[model samples]
Target: MNLLDENNRHPTAITDNSAYDGEPTWSPDGRWLAFASNRTGSGEIYITPLEGGVARQITHHPAWDENPSWSPDRDNPRIAFVSSRDGHFAVYVIDLAFVPGAGLPAERRVSPLEYTAFDPSWSADGRTLIFAASLRGHSEIYAIDIDAAPSADGYAMRPLTDGLIDRQQPAWWP
Candidate 1:
């Protein structure tokens, strides 16, 4: 993978891409990067400090995980990514605070089981999460409040768009 400075100039190779590595997301402080790689045979999320530190694997699931989205909360960073652990690709949220040998960090499934979701993006407030999912039909962007109580039928996913218009990777405005 490569890292570029502001204005998208001066590209620098950050990692030796011996394995498939992609979907890089930067921490709020811009000191570290979180990306998915298949270095260990199965796709997993890993974070590497920009200052010559080794990359540490944050996720260790048998199924592949990808598309990591770091939270804007500098105080307590979190990663939201998609995984195929449950047979279908679903979104899961895990804390970015991974101790070198603390084992797998705690994570929770954020999307409903019925639909396959992808491209998780955090809201500016870090209180809501949005992703693209299709329920046996065309994909649509859906948002869910992470801290809000679950609704009667489970997570209250609010659809941001409707009809046949497709959308993916929703971003938040300041």
Candidate 2:
């Protein structure tokens, strides 16, 4: 991964090591960058400081975990990502405020396992997340309120776009 200036000149390498590193997402404070990498085998979430340092692996699962979207709130640091740990693609959120002694952070599946959700984007307030998912035989954008506790089935999600056309990679304005 590389960082480029506003002018798109003098791009600096962020991850110099050899690995499939991509899908970089900057932290709310811009001090750290969260991205997906296959350094340790399957794709997993990793965080590297912008000031330069060794990248820390945040997620450890046999399945693939990619497409990280950091919460916009600095006080409540969280990362919404796409994971296939449950046998199906789904959106999961990890609370970055807590660091466990071992294993990955406690993940909350924001999207149901039945649907394939990816390309998660966070709302400006960090209270909601928008992503693309396959529902009703078509791919469409959806938004879910992450501020509330997950219901019995999972986090409540609603379609943002009609099923008339396929949509992917929903981005929210800063």
Candidate 3:
């Protein structure tokens, strides 16, 4: 991790290791950073204080877990990321509050199991997630209510944009 100063000069290296870290997202308060790294051989999510500290591993799965999106809600801190832990790529949430030597909190599958989902962006309220998913060979933008009960098909995802176009990342307009 590197921090670029106000003048865009030489970025001060926040991390000085050979671990391939990517997709860094700052917390709502800007006190910490959540990102994915291959330091442990496989992709895993990790959290580190922006002020300089040890990066703590958040996800402990053998499969690839990357693309972390920090929740906007600080009261119920969580991170939404894409993981292939369940056989295929899908959106999953990691509760930060419960991750101190307690293994991982219950895995919360945010995206539908039937689709290959990626790039999860949280709503302002942190109650919803918007991501790109490919189902039936078509890529589309989907918004899912994280707390809503699953439908008969096991997912309550609503499509926001649909087409044959290759849509990968969908972010909410500020």
Candidate 4:
């Protein structure tokens, strides 16, 4: 899919696939573009040069993986996303540099906090991660401090908004 610049003049394909590609998020450094594509038999996250080239699949799963967001600093090298490889859908995180070309060797499952977690949005500062988690039969927003890695003790997550209604898809404000 092509995305237009703010001036609505410059257009970019973001991906080369003629099949289906969308949800393109540029790398913080502006060198690579990350997006979701189904051209590889199943929907998975693919990264390509911002200038455009053969897209490389970043995820390999029989289940779908979508909503990929890059971290602010390349040094940290992290991509937050949602994957349904497990029986139920959940949130996952993978190291861009740590995972080999074969695709994410092993995705760190971050969901199933209360029920299931999906739609993760990384903080611009890159210290926290906010995502939607289904709890008590309803979806809610939750935030975790990535700076403090989750240990055997467990990471603390708090609801951004407390309510009984459903909430899905979360984006952080700069």
Candidate 5:
């Protein structure tokens, strides 16, 4: 998983030996690279260096952890991703600065604690995130303001699409 520079020099293997790997994201500072791999017998997110080195696992579970989106804030280095640890697929987030790896601290499930959510895309403002979820048994798009503290009931998720053809992939306009 070695990444090349602009000059196509300084090649290195990001992962020593991994069966699957994809969705690599560089930190805002461009110091580290985060990606998903199934090397531990189950798909999990891991972070490595663009300069080449052993990767660090960021999620641990029998379920799959895929599609990592790094926060634009470099100090915190938060990562947003999807996971199936709760039987149903949902989105989650973790702070790389405080949580060194998958085992540093428990991963935070940022999606609706009760609803199924997946494929999260960050908003340009970095205070919001867009993801796909089911409401009233109908799949649609949703947006949440992470900056606002979630009520005890749970975080707020507003539907963006009506009950009709599924809106597969969603991205906020630049």
Candidate 6:
């Protein structure tokens, strides 16, 4: 991926690898970037310092994990991403504050198992996540309260738009 200035000039390569890396999201502090890369063969979440260095793999899964969205809260540097590890696309959140190899930080599945959720964006307060999902034969936007405890099936989710037209990518305003 390339980073460009406000004028869309002087684009600099953020990830100049040949690993099909895309969907980059900047952290709240703008010091780091979180993106999805297939460098390890399967798509996994990776974080790299904006200054430059080796990118660290966050999610080491065989299934595709893409569309990473960093929380807006600087204190809670958590990442919300889409993963297909459960045989279906779902939204998951991981705490970046936790050490990488520390017994695998608790991964919370924010979306339910029945739906295909993707392109997650965090609320301004970082307490909710908004994403697009296939529901009732059409794509729609849904919001879930991640701060609340999820039930056995998943977290409490609500649709934001009617299932009239397809809505793929959702961007939450600050």
Per-prediction TM-score to the true structure, in the order listed: 0.89, 0.90, 0.91, 0.85, 0.84, 0.88
Candidate 1 TM-score over all chains jointly: 0.89
Worst 10 residues of 3 by lDDT: 98-107
Against the unseen true structure, what C-alpha lDDT does each candidate score?
Answer: 0.88, 0.88, 0.88, 0.78, 0.78, 0.87
When sorted by TM-score, best at the front, the candidate numbers are 3, 2, 1, 6, 4, 5
Q: Could you tell me how far off, in angstroms, the CA of residue 129 lies in candidate 2 after the best superposition?
A: 0.4
Give candidate 6's TM-score: 0.88
Off by over 4 Å in 4: 5-10, 100-106, 151-155
Candidate 6 local lDDT, 84-142, one digit each (tens): 99999999999877765665655778887888898898889998889999946778998
Instruction: Report lDDT (Cα) of residue 48, candidate 3.
Output: 90
Better by TM-score, candidate 5 or 3: 3
User: Could you give candidate 2's per-residue lDDT for residues 53-96 as a string of tens digits?
Assistant: 99998888899999999999889899999999999899999998
Clashing pairs in 6: none
> Evaluated with TM-score, which candidate comes out highest?
3
TM-score of 4: 0.85
List CA RMSD, all candidates.
Answer: 2.5, 2.0, 1.8, 2.5, 2.8, 2.3
Candidate 3 lDDT over 1-174, as tens digits, reads: 798888868897767789898899999999999989999999999989988889888888899999999999989898999999989999998887775556666558878778999999999988899999998887899998887898888878899986778887889877
**lDDT value for model 4:** 0.78
Candidate 6 stretches greater than 4 Å from native: 5-9, 100-103, 151-153
Runs off by more than 4 Å, candidate 5:
2-12, 100-106, 136-138
Write out the backbone clash pairs for model 3.
none
How many steric clashes between backbone atoms does each model show? 0, 0, 0, 0, 0, 0
